[model samples]
Target: MDVVAWQFLLLVNPNDEDAALQQFAAFRAALEEAGGDADPAALLRDVIDWKAGFHVGEDDAAGLMDALDELASRWRQRIDWGLDDDADAVPDTDAVLQTAFVQLRERHYSLWTAETGEATLSGWITHERDEEAMQLVAGALGLSARPGIG
Candidate 1:
């Protein structure tokens, strides 16, 4: 529905573990208490059944992006595989370094669209992350970071 602001969360477990059910239960309870008009609890129920890492928030884009950027940076560092130690190890800067940034940017936009009701929240809440939709969101946000990537 039309949410004034949104908080998007991405939770991950390297092993693809299953802790989302409990967390979602608690989150739904909180949403109920907050009087989520669109019945976010129901929306979340549909979302968490498949996408364990996805979570919503209440009108907090800046905070969300900051968190995403931090998460992206950490993910990039981990995935870079020690390339940071030496220039020689750098792997196709344009192709490799931008992957995480792109992913993060996409996530930011997807959440925004869903939150703003520009796109249907249930439609956006899919089992998989929609990279294309994310790209659109990032573009709108003018998301930029180091080396002209967002």
Candidate 2:
């Protein structure tokens, strides 16, 4: 996709409707000089929401499992610390994460909540996902099932 100077300016400052044409030209010039074939998608790979959480830091299976175990433990604690008077009412959190497993897929799956938003996939998931996996992730993340992102 060829990005024009005006398009570059719009991306840089969407609110600045009054951005000068000369400034945009200069910006595009610099961008072209730096590299015209720069992949925008690759540059913004980390902009996804599912990439949140503690990095495995290592590329080995043991390291990935350790991270997943730690994440599961922390989430379980938040779901039910066992100190509540009605602890029985709080169902086992393990059932929700039963399907959680480390797999070498095109993308890494993740689940987290607003309060305990400290979980992440050990590796980066940078490809498309099926509907079933998306639903599983949504449920695990405690996201609303109200259809769209309204």
| Leading candidate by lDDT | 1
Task: Write down the lDDT that model 2 would get.
Answer: 0.32
Candidate 2 positional error at 70, Å: 1.2
Taking all chains together, each candidate's TM-score versus the true structure is: 0.29, 0.22
lDDT of each: 0.34, 0.32
Position 30, candidate 2: lDDT: 50
Per-residue lDDT of model 1, residues 1-150, tens digit only: 222112222222122334444544555566767673545534443444324322223333333333334434433422223334445543342333244344444544222222323221211221135454434433343322111221
- Per-prediction count of colliding residue pairs? 4, 3
Reference-based TM-score, model 1: 0.29
